[model samples]
Target: MWHVIIFFWLLYYLIKPKYSRRSLYPPGPLALPLIGNLLSVWLGLKKYKYHHKLWQSWSQTYGNILGLRLGSINVVVVSGKDMIKEISSREVFEGRPDGFLYTMRSFGKKLGIVFADGRSWMNTRRVALKYLRNFGYGTRSMELIITEECLELVKLRKTDAGQPILVNQMFNISVVNILWRVVAGRRYDLNDDRLKRLCALVMRLFRLVDMSGGIISFMPFLRHVIPGLIGFTEMKSIHSSLQAFIKETIDEHRASIDVKNPRDVIDAFLMEMSTNQENAFTEEELHVVCLDMLEAGMETVANTAVFMLLYLVRDEGVQRRVQKEIDDVIGKRQPSLGDRSRMAYTEAVILETLRLSSVAAMGVPHRALDDAHLGGYLIPKGTCLLMAIHDLHNGEFWEDAGTFKPERFLTKEGNIIQDERLMAFGLGRRRCIGEGLAKSELFMFLTHILQKFFIRIPDGDPPPSLKPVDGLTLSAKPFRVIFVER
Candidate 1:
């Protein structure tokens, strides 16, 4: 009798015209009683290619900026570029949404530049920007580091000697080297145990966080009650390993601090901590910030390089053009940041790769703090906004959006034309702080590798399916490539 009553109540709620107040918001499939539209969205959890397909279908049926209930939680997916701009620019929508996974991971503490909001985010971002600028992000200091890493990458690939190499591994090593230099002022050995463990833990955490149907995300209390139900044990183990690694590194930096000159990110952070003891920034913040920087920097750059490799293997013509340009301008020597202007085709290829492959498919979600309007729709405060980067890469916004033609980026007269619609690093005030570093890393590494080796699908294997793996970051599936020495 009680079950019947509850069922009828839920039915009534579903049929009721409660959401009529916000009818102007984009339309979507009618959410059912308790489960809502979660079942439909969660259908492609196992296969990555289907995940984006599901979202695309939803947008096609409902219009851009559609709303749905993910097991009682409101999920607003903004597909259009104009809507993304409006939402991301507003303070009301500038904050990240509260989730069980985030709370558990950080224990409600916003440490890294990625999760920190408002004052902390602003302060940390400003500090990081200042430090990166001084460290030669736009200048020549960091470019030297990138060039060295690329050189090391080429040597490493040479060892494989025209055989299929897992390009992802090489990309990971190069990215980790760049990150290690920025954080600790030195690069790690290719076989460093600590670096390997750190990378593994980060990859695991990313997988856990990206999974859509995690119980912890919806039911925070389950973290305490059911424990195993939320995968808290694994989460706790990974967090402990990462936290310990960060704490030890920071302590080492503290012991070796040279007041006359700061070394790396740690040295700069310690200097700030010494001057500003009263503020919220603490040793704990420093530890988490280092962890955040490593995780964010590694995953983004590695996935990007992997995507570029996939494209090169799949399209021989595009590969040949880029390689020809590299050979003409850079010759046998490794490419450097200084060579970026001379290598226009290579630069355009990088841009086109970012466009064709949407790495950060649905960018970090933002919450609106105040009422805002975008794309003929009024977005109320507290509304969650999702920027669909994948949609932007396909829509009519760019000429020949479907094609992987780098020539589109080149002017009719053969000049590189910058396109603002490429928001892989995101847009507005909250754009990626490490954009300069990431750009340099991608350009130099790709040029160096292509110059020395020709990448092709492994013998007896079909061309790597350009399909991306699903996660918070859209990663490429494991594929091998033959590196024929140039």
Candidate 2:
């Protein structure tokens, strides 16, 4: 029958490359005929909270930079901070792949900032940064916006004090509101049903990317044949829902757009579209860009805050020290950005949290624009590159890297030291566009929460596992906390 013929054809097509073109690639496990190293790589990540475990184990035998064959594509993972930093900065390595899922998510084109490359990415990033600054990206106004939201978060927690509460979800409202204000010129109420749905959908989308090393991201073809098996159906539904929401927001901005008087990121983007007809900024692109920023901003900081709280919950001494630091520096009045420099311990806690739990453990997939040499290995153009940040952080970069010691980021003079090794937001042109805003928001939220409440494990329940759940972000499992009033 035709089915058997097609099966043989696919087998021959997949197996052909292993015999002929395997020599040019960097050394990895000898891939099997047709499937390559797909099964091993997939099975390797099936059991861990962080995918870096699998890569770190492989890097020992194959050097810091080694390639793996996933399906028909070749992927190179870079370990250790030095190699990750070098590979991440290369201009030739700045391009993104045209994989089915990558393109499909961005409306069948690399239209937005996250999955885009070349001139489109360049133009969009430049314009977005410029206008986002005008909208209070790194200024005191931004700090105030975040602080205001933090107050809402505190109020919400106070309402449910001493109850078994999912602190991460509560943090979600405040974090989303800050970005919502900056990007959309408005803030959703903490109890708004729309805000909750939007945040949940975005979180689910990222979690899908974490399962089985995000098999669907590169192997999107499986979705066509076996959507349920591959998680493509859920991903598509979430994307469609998010897209519709973004479209409505953009349409609202379009109707009320003023040339001289821009409101937020949406209006600013519209103004740019009005003038820059030649660039890649379009209505569809705007939706993706908004979603990109929203998706990046919402869960990352919240998850981090939860991680910090997990540490605080487990280590009461450190928790008391953080609170004491907050008390000495900022007192009872809302913690401001100005207090950050003096609160070295609090700053170190944030830095350490980022180091220990790198939310985006693997940097977004980077594709080679042309044949390139790295660590003596030739990476062919279109080869995918991954930054195993877990290995990078756990390597020789930090003394006692396995421990949760914030003092590593502190000096003898009690000042916070800035290490280039702490690359949670990444490096170079493709680094997180909202890093400035995110840092501001994160600092404010953590300080404000610690100032008002003591984060503790819930009563009459077994202590939940401290190991983070594997996802696009390394996050605490859904464990409840009792926020005892300070």
lDDT against the true structure, each candidate: 0.75, 0.80
Candidate 2 residue lDDT tens string, 340-439: 8788998898889888877777867788999888887778888888888766666777888867888898989989999988888888877887777777
In candidate 2, stretches whose alpha carbon ends up further than 4 angstroms from where it belongs are: 1-21, 46-50, 211-213, 396-399
Which residue pairs does candidate 1 place in steric collision? 92-368, 92-369, 92-370, 93-367, 93-368, 93-369, 164-481
Q: How accurate is candidate 2 locally (lDDT)?
A: 0.80
TM-score of each predicted structure versus truth: 0.89, 0.92
Model 1 Cα lDDT, one tens digit per residue, 1-486: 999999999988886654653675556777777666756656645443455556767787778877766664566777777767766676667876666666455656765678667887788878876766665556777778788878877787787787767666556657877767877887887667777777877766766654332456555666778876557778889888888877788888999999779988788888988887777467777776777777888988888888888888888998999888888888876577888888888889889988888777777777665666666665666555677788888677777786778888898878898876788888878788778788888898788888888888877987777777666777777788988987
With candidate 1 superimposed using the best TM-score fit, by how many Å does residue 257's alpha carbon deviate from the native? 2.0
Question: Which candidate ranks first by TM-score, i.e. highest?
Answer: 2
